[model samples]
Each structure stands twice: as C-alpha cells, then as structure tokens.
Target: MKKTRYYPFERNRYFYGKLLTVRDFESEQKYFNDKRRLMNRLLHGTGVITGLQVIAVDDKSVSVEMGAAIDALGREIIIPSPVTLKLSMMQGFSNNEYAKNVYLCLAYDEKGKEPVHSVANAAVRSDEISEYNRMLESYKLFIREEAPDPSVFPIESIIEQTSVLYQDGHIRILQRTPRYVNPGQLFDVTFVIEKTLQAAKISFEFELVGQQLQAEHDAKVTFNEPQERQETEYEVTVKLRADSSSRGKATVGIRQDHAVLRIGDKQVSLSSARANEVMIMAGAVDKQWVDDFVNRSLEDSLDSPSDPCIYLARISLLQMGPTYMIEKVDQVPFNEYVYNASALHKLKSKDSSAPATPFSGSITARSSLRKIAGNQEPELNVTFNKDKGELNFDLGLPEVQSGDQVRTGVVEIPIASLNKFAASPFGRGGKSYVSAEIEHGLGRGSLFIYTGIEEINEDYISDILSSSERLYSGSTDVFKGSEHEPSGPDVKIGTVLYPQKGTFRIGVRLQQPTEATQINIRWWAFKKATESGAGSDDTVDISSLEAASGREEQA
Candidate 1:
C-alpha cells in the first residue's frame, strides 16, 4: 500500500536533515569529477599506458625511465602506445621508424668526415636500452617476488593462466603458468610461493626448452573419507636466471587431526584435506557386530507407544528419520476453539458436513510422513490430485449411537475411537482421510457417503526446514501469512483454528443431535518428487490420503 525510497549516498554525506543536489556543484568541481572518471577508465581499460615504467627495482626506489623520443629541437616528446601491443611494436611506433633510418645513415656516416646524418644512432641505442630495461622489470615481477617500486617503475604483472585436471577418481588439480620476460641484467633470480594443504602430497619440477622455460607440479589426493575439520599447508619454490635456466620444488604437509569418512552407508571418523577426493585404504570387515547393533535398536521399538499416534510417529520415523527419542512429547501451544460464526463464513468445502453451529470448521491440513512408512501406514496409499485448487475428501464414518458426536480438534484423533476402530497406522500430525462412505451397522441403514481429503482455511501452511541431522531429518511447524511467519501456537479443540499441515477435523453435529454413535475414519499418505530448480534438491513428497489401520507398539 505504501513505498519508501533509500538513497545510496545518504549514509556517508551525513547531511541527513538537509537535501543536497549534485547539480548545485561549481563548474570546476564537476570538471574535476568528469576528468577523474575519464582517466580511471583509460588507465583501467585493456593495455592503456600509464606513462610510467620500471627498469629495475630494489628494496628502495626502482630504476626509472620514460620511454619517449627526442624531437628536432632536442625536446623529449612522449607518445602513447597501448601496452597491450608487443614491446617491439611499441618501440617502433614510439621511435617513429627513426632507428631504421639511422641504421642506413650509419653506413654512410662511417666513411665521411662531416656526414649528413638523417637520424642519430645514439637515439636508437638509447631506445633499445630502454626497451631492454622494460623487459627486465617485467620478468622480475612475473617470475620472482621482487616488486619494482611503483613510484618509479611501471610494469604490469604478467597474467597467470590456469588449467584443470578432472580424472583418476574425482581429482580437480589446477596448474597456473605465469608469463614473464627474461631481464638480461639479472644473472639469476629465485621465487617462492606459499600454499596450504591437508593430509595430501604435492611436488614440483621445471623444464627448459631453448629460450623458453616452464615449471610444473603434481598433486595426488585421496578422499576415501571426509576431510578433517581443519586446515593444511604446502609451499612452492622456483629458481631462475637470465641465462634461460630454471628450477622448482614443491613441499606438502598432511594433517590427520580430524578426518571423517562417510561413503555410501558407512560412516567413519578420519582426518584429511578438503581438497583431496581420492583414497586408498585396507579391507572390509564383514561381521555380525554391525548387524547385531542395528537389530538391537529395532528390537525395542515396541517399548515406545502402541497407539495409532505412535504408529503414525513410527511410520514418520521410518519415512523420515533419525528418529529422535524424547522423554515426553512436547505439545505446541494452540488455543482451544469455541464456535465462531463470523470466521466460519470462509469455509467453502463442498464435502464438509452441514454446519450445525452457524459456523464452518473446515481448516485445511497438509500431513507430512516419511515415504519409507508408506507400506505400514494405510494413509500413504490413497491418491488425490491437486487440480483447480480444490480438495476432494472421502469421509467414511462408522456406525454410532443415535446420540454419538465426534469431538474435534487439531491433529487430535479421538483416543477411544482410535482404540476401537483405528485400522490405519497414524503418526503425530498424521492425517485421517474420512471418505464420504456411510456406515451400516446393526439396526442401522446405509447413508449417503463421500470420503478422502478435505480443505479448510488457506491461512495455515506447514514449514519443514532443514534440520541439523541427515537431509531427511526436518521438523514440521505451522505458520500463517505468506508462509514466512514463525509458528506461534497450535490449534486447540472445539476452537475454529488453522493447522500448518495435517488432516482437517470438523465436528458433525447431527440435526437430531445425538452423542451415542461411532464414526470410523481412515487416511493414507502420498508423495511426489520436486522438479529441478535452483536452491532445491529434488525428492519432495506431498502427503496423500488412504484407509488402512496399522499399530505401533511400545517397548
């Protein structure tokens, strides 16, 4: 309904209360800003000369020289030759081909006593010396750690190129080759680079081909186990000189302090490096000890709860896991409902029983259960399509007394009814799909029937965020408003409320208003895979409805 504007420069100006306009700036200020911007663009653009260079650099000021030409009046004139071009080309253009003309004149000038020289040979020699110095500075920075003084020397670092190797068991090794020129002044120079690694090994070597030289290294790694939760270290050293000779060495350090290996179904504690992906290890131990442990954990599963809730919980544990053991279940705070006529005006489900309290109580619920429990849980088999934003519920009611009434609540199945006729396995937050099937019992006739899932208020949504355990271990919570709000409380019985997910329960108060009858209900689970997309890891399942009773016994 409303909007706000945030200015980027407001924070730094501190002219918080005062509105300032850039248009109010003086002409000189604007001119300076524009000129600064242009210079920055030209200097940063590919290969533009900055009019500075290094002939050689020591710990202090580096050898400085301007690559310019002397004019006819003996004044030095600077020229612009984009550095992206070759040094020989830059020299040729900067010298204006005067060196070639001088070479021709030197042949005739040597035989004459006051020769008419078209160009100066000294100028050509000076240009050659300056170009050589540029090369010397280039290689120093590129091949060695020696940095030419930026104040006097202007040589850009050579660009480093890299290549990747992905073979021999998922290893990703990168090799970088640095470009540099051979400085004729330097007889020799050494280079050292620092690297970090884990419990892996790496080595380096160098090769010289005529005037060209190169260095390389080999790193072999294994990731049979998860890398240690720590850091590792490594180093590389290179030696070079103007004679076109080169040497290199690589040193690796391994750390096994916190290695952990989780391959397929096996989880082991090991130490390794994050970069390593290959491993060589010893044999497999096939013993019943592991099987015995697994069997023992499942053997006492009956000691838990034997009710349908437990069955549902067990099924959920099966479908979704690392089943957490708790001393007692924590009940989220939900307000108990009393009949509200105004709110019920929004319940539009056609399958819901006729509203008796002048109010509708059909609040939609989305149940969440693990797929592994589909076989044991009857609700997992029932199918329903989410088409046109409408839900089709199958409400199957069992025989009951004339005065019987079904108590209603959020995720609360009548314990007595479940104990009597809950044929399907249910879990905490498990939904019971009551189809439209009518019950015909002793002395009772068949009634019109419908069954399946039901929809209530669209206000509630269930959020299952990633948990700290396995990918499948996540907690289910309810939320309101755009599915972004944190869950506040749960829905209370008899209260018109919305649940984030699960089965919707509506109390059907017969017109005769009896409380002595039975209502049988059944529900199943459903699942579907999520489509591929960013930030999503497929394999997501939406709950389904079905009817089959399963039990979970406590140990």
Candidate 2:
C-alpha cells in the first residue's frame, strides 16, 4: 500500500489564485481544472443550476427559481436560496468562456455553508475584477434578449384562473318517471333545471292518439325563486282513460310550449321546447284464446280431407277479426262422442270334430238428435227402418210451461239405431255415414255421424261384443266357451277362432244453446272369428301355375 497524500483544503474546499511563474502555473492550472470539473459534476448531478432562471442579479445576491433534484441515494437536495458570489474571486477567467458558464454554479455553492469557493482570503485583483463585472453585464443583456415577452406569460396565467368560472342556467328533462303505464293509471313526469327563475312558468301538453281513441290535455306550473345556483326538479301527474274504446297501443307525448320568466318587473319569454313520444298500452284481450283458435283453424285447413266449414270459418274470422264473437263463446267447451257397430255370424260345427264354417256379416249406420232441455221434454219423431237402412229424427218445438224462461229442446237418436243401420249391406266393409239437419227456435243444430268401425266375421264365431260399451263403460266381453282356449299357433292354422270388437260414435253439436244441455250417443259391436279355410302358403310352383290361366287355356 502506498501512502495517501491529501491536500489541506482539498475536501469541500475551493480556491482563487493567480499564476505567478511558469513553474507555479502547472499546479495552479491543475487546481483550477479539478475545481471546475468538481463544480460541473455537482451542478449536473444535483441539478442545482441546470434550469436556473435569473430573476434579478446584483453585487450582493442573485434571485432564481429552480426545482430540487435527487442525489445518488434518491434523497432530495434543494438549491440554497439567495445564491451569492464575491466578485473579486473570479479574476483573469475568460469573459466569453468559463466565467459566464460557471457564474450560476459558483453562486449556488457560495450560498451553501460548504466551503466551495477557492480564495478564502486571497487579496483581490482590481483589473481582473473589472473584467468579471463586464462579463456579468454581458450575461444580463443576453438573458434579456433571449427571454420571451412578459405579455405572453399573462395569457396562460389568465386561462387557468378563468377555467373555474360558474356555469350559466340550463334546463333538462330528468326522467319520464313511468315510461310504461296502463289505462286509467297515473304516471309522473319530472323536469330539472340548474337554477331557479322568478315567476318561471312551465307549460306542458299531453296528447293520446290511437286507432280507437284520441284525446289531449294541458297543464302549467309557476316557480317562485330567490335565484340560487342549485338543482331544481318539478313533477307532473297525468292519467289515462278507463274504457274498452282505449284498447290498443296509443301514442302519448308531452308537447313543449314557450315558458315565461319574470325578472323583477320585466317579462322574458324562453322556449322550453321538448317533443318526445311515449307508448302506452290500454284495455285487455284474450290473447291465449285467439292464438289457440288460430292454430286450430290453420291445422283444420291443412287436414288431409279438409272440412269446408272449418276453412270458410277461418277465412271469415280473419276478415272479421279474431275478436269478433270470440268473447261470447271463449269459455264454452264443445261436445263430441263416438259410436261403433259390428256384426258377428255364428257357424255350426258338425259333431265337434270338423271346424266351424265361416259366415257372412253386415253393418249399417245413421245419426240423429238425442235430447232438448234438462227437465222439459220435447216431442221427438224418430224413425229407424232396418230394411230400408234409413234413420231419421225430427225435433218439434216444446210446449212452454209456466216457469220456462226460453223454448229449448234436444233431439237425439239411439245408438242401437246406428248399429242396425251399420249391420245393413250399405254400411258394411266401408266408411259410410249420414248427417241430419235440425231447426230449433233458439239455435241451429246439425247431427254428425262419426263412424268408428264396420266389420264382418269371415271366420268361426268366438264371441259377440259392443266396442263403445267396452271403451266408455269399461265392460269386457265374455265368451260362453272355455277361457283357456288357445287362439292359434304361431304358424298359420287351418282354423283360428277369435273375437274382434269395434266402435262407432255419433256426435250432435248445438250452437247458441238457451240452457245447459248435453247430447250423448254411442254404439259398439263385435265380430266373432269363423274358420274360413286353411291358411295356405302364398308361394306356388312356377312350373304348375300359369300367370294367366284363363287366357292360357285359350292359347
């Protein structure tokens, strides 16, 4: 380790000296150069004189405004106030170079308690001191020439001060309190203003326009004020109509008008104009029923064999509007029922060894009215001719009793008549039906034949039963033979015995009934199995069987 030589005034010390000879010049030049470097480092590192602006300078002091900068450890170092420097210390320094540049830095260090000046008590040099004075004057002139005009600074300063001025008066529609409302319901509308005015009257006009109804109304309110800068709110209440004629979406609005404001004795007219439309729905309709009716009507039109009456009724409803006559029959439930007919032919078995032979069966049908009123009986002329395969029902006006409110009667035919008709040749083995028209004083009526089944037994008889009785009455058919009798083998048997049941229904609909009434007619039949023949194999030998046997023989 080498010995460390230290200068007595090296640390936190500065000096001002003159070059006496060539030999002493080196030490003095190195001393001043190190001092200059240290000063520059402190000025840049601590940011003390980096942005210093000279406010006023004199022999005693220099005024400056500057920001603090951080040291290496991030501690803030503030520039000392009232920076001052001794004029005699800056001797022989170049006026254009080091003197002008280091002037502010020297002033900053001089003001601090730290010993940053070089010539602690060195005697002053008169001529060099005068040169420093001339440099300082030159600096002052340069600063004045480079600085912007003082007038430009006042503009930015004024903008900042005026940015916080109070705002002028304005009115706003705060809210349409109840945007949606029902008929006859009251709704509130609110308005707000930044400041209140004396004798300020706000006028409002409300109008309702729709396909079914139209109405208009107006209201006004005046305000009393001490004219304070505060938020003010006003509310108005309006009501809708309470009637069926108000049914539909109606346009409701608040119309604007010129408002009058009084300032002392002078009247001022202000346009408080606002035009906004609010929609309000009123009245009530059975939307669910209409939707269901339209769906059912469209389905009826798309039916494979469409009903003409249903199609025509749908078109009429569309033209007349679904609401037409819907309120009258919305809650009414239509009546419907079914009647079935079948024939069973019993075959005789010889000596219980040979199988029973198959027999021919027939079915026929007709529909008619059933009943009229609950208690009051009406004269019904019904005719069922099995030979002619015809059935008719005529309903006559009932004799009015003492307590009767209206004349009403129900005409209906028996289910047995339909079974007899179905057993005829005309109704056998096919869908056959007959409808009848009935005239009554209260409502027009029509009878519909809803035939379920018409079948014959081409096999051995097993049992005979009614299909409607088995369905509606829950009655099962009973055979006289053994219950354990096998139906048949999986493979086709020569003779198979089984019982088959069928149902036929007849429905009579009466519109505009004067009283609560019901008409029900149902019939059922069963065709017993008869052994027709052996279940022969459908495949045949191609060589033995001819494609056209009749024409082949002629060929």
Candidate 3:
C-alpha cells in the first residue's frame, strides 16, 4: 500500500486508437475512488454518525452494533450487522509490542482477504494470469493497535472505534441537569463508571455560559460551606456505592479572591443509589444568577392584572412614599363589642414589608406621619373635660405646608404629668366628640382608635407598670435633630410606668405636600393596660393650684 500516486492529468483517455493497458485501467479507477473519498472526508468529517455502540459481551470480547460512519479518508462504512470480536484473538494484540487500544475498523480489501473467491485473480494457468481482478473491492473489518494509513502494507483504514475502556459499561451521566444555570449557583448532576476505573480520568465538565473561570482557581468543589484549600486535588470518598459503581463523594472547588467557592458534595450509595441531600453547592454558579435575578423581580407581587404596574408607576411618577402603620390599643373593649375577640387570634409578625398591610387588631393602624421640621412647632392645646372625664388634645398649624420651608413636629406629653388636674369634679355627663377633618387626606393610611380610663389604687404598680415601654417624640429637627429612638422596648410599644416618656410624633412626606393638609388621628388615651393606669412626671404650678379649705371645697 505504498502511497497511491496520481497526477491531475494521469486519468486515461480512451479513444479509437488508444492502447488499453492494465496500468491505464488502474489509474482511471484510482482517480474516481480518490475523488469520492475526498468528498466523504470533507463533507462529513470523520466519526460514527449513528448506531456504533460497543457493548461488552464478556471480559475478553465486545460486540460492535450495526452503524454507519465516515472515515478520515472519506470512506463510507456501514456495518450491516453486529460484529463481535475476541480481544485476545485480535491481530494487534499479538503483533503490536504494546497494546494500548485496538481499533476495529471497516476497510476496502482488494486482495480477496475476505471469503469470496479465496484468491486475488481467477486464472486457468499461472503463466496466463490477469493482473486485474473480476471481483469488486470487498468491505471487511480489521483490528489493529494503530489504524493503518494509505502507506501501510495493506492499509486497514477507516473511522476510529470507541475506546475499549469507555464503551457501554464505562461512563454515563445519570442525571439531567438544568440547561441554563448561573455561573456560581449550585446544581446537582450524577455520572457513573465501573468500580475499578480511576474516576478522575473521565472528564466531568460543567458549562458556564459566556464566562470562564481560571481552571483549578476560580472554579471550586465544595462538600458544604466552602473553605480555602491549598491542595490541588479535592476529593473525599463517601462510603456506600454499588458493586459496579464508580460513584462516591467528591468535591469541586475554585479559588475565590475572597474564599474558596465550592460546588456541593457528590455522594452516592448503592442502597439508595441516590446521593445524599448533600447540597451540591453551586456557589458561583448560583450566585451569579441570584445577583442578576433577585433584584430583577418585584419586591412585592400583586394579583390584579394592572396591580404591579399600578404600584410601580405611582412610585416612579408621583415619587410616592411607603405606607406606614400606627396602632393605638385600649385595655378595655367597647361596651357592645365581643369579649376577648382580638385576644383569640394572636398572629405572629413576618417582620417585613407586606404587599398590602392588613389591619391587625388588638389595635393596629397603618398610616403615614410627616417627618417634621422642629422649627415653628405646632401648639398642642390639651384640655380635660370636667363633666365627661375625657381629655381632648389639638395640635394645630394654619398652613401645614407652603413653598420651600417645612413644618413637621414631634410633641411628647406625659400621661402622669396631666394627672395634675386629678379626677374632674364633673363626672360622666355629655359625650365629647372628635370631628373627622383629614380623613380624606389619608391615601394609603389607617388609624386605630382606642380610649379608656382605668381606676388604680396607686399603691401597687403591677407587672404591667414595672415592665412596659414608655415613649417620647422622635426627632423634630429635620436637619439638626434630637434623638430618634428610645432606650428599649422593641417588641413592646407605648407601655407606661410613672411616665418616663410618652409617644407623640407627626410625620408627612415633603415631596410637594398639600397646601392645606390635615391629619385625623383617632385618639388613644393609654391610662391603662394589663389591668393598670397611667400617671407621672412634669413641673407643677403651685400658684395655679390653691389648697382647698372645708368651706372652699363646698363653694
């Protein structure tokens, strides 16, 4: 099989007076064969196009299933039937000095090596023999260590076969992973091979679309929370695998400039055959998608068709403020209200912003209050009703908002300080009322109103009084501010004990506020809680309070 030689013009030209020699016939045959093979190689590029699976029939033999393929030299190879070969009987095994792999290929044999006429030429006598054969080139299988090229003695050339170690029982990816994955996110995938094979030899590839991390550096393997490791080889075998399995625990890790980002554990057990819930940490894989997607979603979802758009549009166009809530709870229920109604259902708070704030009642309201400017504070006129035993409070401002200047305020009035008036001489007569003035101005706001007076002996400040949170105004100064938060009482609000401080603050959004805006606050007088009353602290006017005489008391 010395390299078949030919020139572009070497093709024989047959005419009425041309010599018809064997060499001329052979050269013409070579030209067409080479041309066809070139098209097969260039158009189809080599390898098994379909159905060339190699299944292990035994420890010493393998079965190559029927298939069609193209070879390196552009030959059409069609295995009409499954072919089985004994590995030890292969010619390459005995002939080659070192047998690494045996390639079983399809080739064109013109020597009549395949069973047909058993000889190259059909000749009656040895002296009168013909060089040209009557039989066509036969397709046959050949086994060799290194496949033969055209220059070989008898070229056994065709497409390469599957590796003997990597056929049917060799490797298989058992799990289907998500098609699209973020670069650092953790994802689970399982691949398997026979028990005796070195697992690391097989390639377990992960795809990170568009982005490539430096190998052995940016990419990482993790069993759990990833930690930095100096060792380049990251592997830890978890016990429990099938008798035939190469499955075990391993880690994939990469170097993070900050820390080792790990892909979670790859664990397998035969009984379960399923890996442990061992988190396949896809850290960077998962992280990239999270950073890209988390914020892309809405903070809150709405059910209405236009609801998402409605909320988003309002915030963008109007520059609207977030909805806030305030709760005013009365110790005593209304005279006609259901007993212990609110106490029946005690729900836990999610401790986050809800899409729509529902009114949770023991007493609760969601409303907006202005962030006030401490300058030009509103005057609060607090008057106690002598007949009704009710106290009324009014903090008024004529023009709540104007051009540029702001008018926001924080006012704290202690309940115990107001106790200076003592019990009103007039008790329970006419009903005092509050006018709903700014009720319409409350856009997405709500108010909870509760009012009551509890009689306490003053001798005992019960558990309620000892362990409650008293409040005071938040900073009124918009720029130069007072303290905004209190010392304690996180879960508890507006609890009273001899009036350390009491809560009162008015807040409003300064984004082009109303020219004549009013806020209606349903009053909550906390003179009571868990069976106790309010009292304490402030300078008293001795001159305004005259000591009563026996005759003066009657008058």
464 in model 2: Cα distance from truth in Å? Answer: 99
- The sequence of per-residue lDDT tens digits that candidate 2 reaches over residues 303-346 is 22110000000000001222111111011011101111221122
Stronger candidate by TM-score (1 vs 2): 2
Ten-residue region with minimum lDDT total, candidate 1:
101-110
Instruction: List model 1 lDDT by residue over 1-555, tens digit each.
Output: 010111121222334575555454444354453444333322222121223233222211122233332211111223333222222222112222111100000000011233233343455453242212111111101111111111111111122223222111111233233333222101111212111222223232322222322222112223332132222222222222222242222112222333223333444332222221111111111122234334543223212111110000000000113221111111111111122334455553354454443223322222222223322423332322222121223223322112221222223233223454555333223222222222121112111222221222323222234221111101213323544332211212221212222223333322221222333223222212222223322222221221121111111
Highest TM-score model number:
3
Q: Each model's TM-score, in the order given?
A: 0.15, 0.17, 0.27
At residue 143, what lDDT does model 1 achieve? 12
Taking the tens digit of each residue's C-alpha lDDT, what string does model 3 give over 393-414?
A: 3333322222111112222222
Query: How many backbone clashes can be found in candidate 2?
Result: 31
Q: Write the number of the candidate with greater lDDT, choosing between 1 and 2.
A: 2
Superposed Cα deviation of residue 450, candidate 2 (Å): 94
